[model samples]
Target chain A: MTVSTALPAVPVTAALPDKKNRRGNRKNSTLATVLLLLGAVYCLFPVLWVLIASTKSSGELFSTFTLAPSTHLFDNIGDLFAYRNGLYWRWMANTALYAGVGAAVSTLVSAMSGFALAKYDFPGKRFVFNVILAGVLVPGVILAIPQYLLLAKVGLTNTYWSVLLPSMISPYGIYLSRIFAAATVPTEVLEAARIDGAGDWRTFGRVVLPMMKSGLVTVFLFQFVAIWNNFMLPYIMLGDDHLYPLTVGLSGLLNQGANQPSMYITVVTGALISIIPLVALFLGLQRYWRVDLGAGAVKA
Target chain B: MTAVTALPTETRTPRTATRRGRRAGAPYSFLAPALILFVAFFAAPIGYAAYLSLRRVKVSGLGLGAGARTEVWAGMSNYARSLTDPDFLPSVYRIGAYGLIVVPTMLGLALLMALLLDAGRTRVGTFSRTAIFLPYAVPAVVGSLLWGFLYLPRVSPFTDVVQMFGVEPPDVLTGSWVLWAVANIAVWGGTGFNMIVIYTALRAIPTDLFEAARLDGASDKQIAWRIKIPIVLPSLIMTFVFSLIATLQVFAEPMTLKPLSNTISSTWTPLMKVYRDAFVRNDIYSAAATSVVIAVATFAVSFGFLKLVGNRAFNQED
Candidate 1:
């Protein structure tokens, strides 16, 4: 009870500190700021390096000082575009289709299943929920090979369905949606909707879906990043280069960097481009990021 | 639907019975899509993997005919092979060591950063928070690539600084140092997200609780250690368990760095070994057994942590 009331009083109490004690707080804050900025620097160093490094030409990438920026960003991007008949752009598009569409459908499915589990009283609800809870703990990448073999048997291995299908059902998404539904969607409102002669599907679409929109967006972002960052699943499943996502395709470029040092620019350049979309998403939707590790059981 | 409507007439009111009948099948219909996908992708694959684990390709009659080799039940032999393989134990040991370094160090840093942010006295809190959390967006492969180049002698800015001072930079991507190098990448990528979780939990603590502590003259450090730590223990523990599971299955970082260094191999970690076995070596039976072992171990560790923590954080909502 105290915790519930305490949540609302947080910002008000934080801003109510008296002026007399502010002097003592200033000293400690300086040290805290320095320590935090140090962490910030460590985290931002690589990102900064990528920004500067992407500007170098292939010859300048190795010859010049590593952090020094050269005026070749446009040329490198142009080269990346022209490489292999614009393969890099195909990878970018493939990643968008995988993460964007995959996350959208997964969020809808999770919303439906989570709404059912939370709002409805059914016979096997506990069993269904427990199975999903256990699925949340299962190391998903462990199933990659088995899924590959099974898909191979069904002749679905080399197709987009192989990646999109497995990516659609996120146990973690369903789990979060359940929590959001129970917390935000009131039983009384649901009963009122039913009393108005609304069917199950209609109530869900009209009432529950709007209430769960923000939470569903959170679910979408989570699954989007999960699918986007995924390397092993698509790495193992997709055999064709044209069908590969950015992570897999870029890693392939890195592997080629071992023999041809010239390819290092492309790998670095590709790595730079791949992260821009994610960094933009992260910065833009910063508020929607609520990570409950217990939901996903594992996130990377 | 029939079952709900056919309940004993004397035992139920007509209105309640009719309502139950209307709502009886709705939940299942809504759950149908998820359940179908789960069975097809989750349960079926697990069951098939278990089936393959206990089977092996049997070769007979000089293996010369059209049906020279056939898959047959091998009982526990595949499990024995996976367990007894020379690569298995070392991979497990390496990952165990890596987890020890990662889980504590990462969580400790996360806790410290969260406490500092919660202190709220600093002007840099919001900037530091966003900057630190930015790496969570970068994929592990990209993070590894960026760090791998930074570890290189020719391309490292740190190397440039060291050479100016007439000293050689320590080899970070070779020998035993490579473990820490890989561990560093994981820490760099993970610390920010965990920090955000712990920080969010900290923000939920009512400031009035700390007002009394401050009146009693508690220092910031003292307040953090005594008050905030206990309050956010559940989030800390949850993050720790999740990190342990993730660290055990470390794949992308090592795989990404393999092109740059010789220290990493096909079996640098258990998951990497599973990938190598199933794909590179074409040993599906052994790979399935190894994967099952890893999966069971992950479940046991995660649930064991939950049990130790009394399972309150997850179930308390219910």
Candidate 2:
């Protein structure tokens, strides 16, 4: 199903000869190593700080050394869980549902649309593609207010559909899927499927989807992270805290931290815990995060 | 394949005609979902925003009953008010300043890190790449909160270290420094993603090109400056345009930081102003006008940048 499986293989050593480059690049390599390490430390600083900060009780948070770790990690999690009758867990679950379902549906829609645009020579293809390209440029935040108003007219605002529906259509995902479709799925295979009496739907299901599997993973992850990280759409749409995603919930929690300093620990703990699932997902799918913005431009 | 080719000419022609007929309708069926959603979400909202921007609520008397507060044509009045609103211009200026600070520094660092990573002379490549890109996984809200705490004097290691040296650490969450403090969180969160983008483009370049340059006695820096950068210029331009667009829509970071800081106002950015106008002030007309203005300006900047750069990034689509 992966794109690599479709390609002819080359000898491994010829493709990646590691020993030769290491011997001559030693001197400058040290400087590059140091600079990269510095960048890594800079990036990791706040994350490390948050980890330590979350372990501190509200009292130790301000009084103790900034880097000092404490034994309040479990207590902080317990406290965060107990806050407002396990609302934090609700937010976590809502975020998962929103991201997981939204991305899954969005990916499928993108795949279908992309496959049509790529494989079939339909009327208005250029216009359809151009419109979607323009969609990619539109500032999504600008659309939030109008989306909210329009949804409210139908009384769909403040509901889960308000957030989930908007998250479903991603122009960028469709655009990327088109590129993937053109690159990975061969016309010959599709033609073969058609000759064997497979319908268009069957061809897409059996032939196209599996071939674009890796590329679709990239699109799914992009949309997943985007929906997971989105603040405005849900913040503007949903009023019920139970329907709130982690971003909105945690933000509201920090807003409360202004009145009660103790809420700061809860916010910090919430922030720390919220990031773990995404960070794990990100790391696990590290190799698939190949994003080349100039991909179409380069080929053309 | 053999079966398809071995079919009789008359039979094949009829089947081909039927297949062509089916193919004509197939793409539309496949595209139905995306098109429906696009019209409902993207096209409709934009049209409604534009329509609402041109109209306003006309209160006949005390504005009490249903018929009393009727919607009517306001023409350019809402647009005029939005443009002339005192909070609007300053937010624009502030965003201008923020973008000026964010786009270059972030992209510059991204390009540097990408070049370094592509150099293949580095140690702990995986660790460095992972660490730098880690911030991307953290939502802007959480990233802002983490930095918000880091900016607080009582809990900041920077403040602690400065006190150890008998020097006062400047408070980052107050006065004008808060702007850069917010900008710093953005740069920190954004750089890694941009770096990975540029690095992906760099990896796409053929290795023999670099091998040829090295054989010609060109240093790594020389190869990067003269060859690699020029080659990835398209990606750089694309990233720049995307970064510019993102910079204009700054919201979550500042909103998250509001609780921790005194300086960031309800109208700190243009989007925030739109939010305040629509929800807080209950003025949808003006909000719609401002949203249109922001959307138009984004289109202008994006198109203008693309045109300036020969529109190479998207010209390939045609």
Whose lDDT is greatest here?
2
Task: Compose the digit string of candidate 2's lDDT tens values, residues B91-171.
Answer: 999999999999999999999998887776755566777889999999999999999998889988888788889999999
TM-score of each: 0.92, 0.94
Relative to the unseen true structure, what is the C-alpha lDDT of residue B40 in candidate 1, on a scale of 0 to 100? 88
Q: RMSD per prediction, one decimal?
A: 4.5, 3.9
RMSD of 1: 4.5
Give candidate 1 regions above 4 Å deviation: A1-28, A292-300, B1-19
Q: State the displacement of the C-alpha of residue A110, model 2, in Å, after optimal TM-score superposition.
A: 0.6
Worst 10 residues of 1 chain B by lDDT: B1-10
Clashing pairs in 2: none
Kindly provide the TM-score of model 1 when superposed on the true structure, using C-alpha atoms.
Answer: 0.92
Instruction: State the lDDT of candidate 1 residue by residue for B102-212, as single tens digits.
Output: 888888888889888777777666677788888999999999999998888888888889889999898888989989999999999999999988877776667788879
**Model 2 misplacement above 4 A:** A1-28, A297-300, B1-13, B315-317
Residue lDDT tens for model 1, A32-93: 88899999999999999988988998888877998899998998888899989999999999
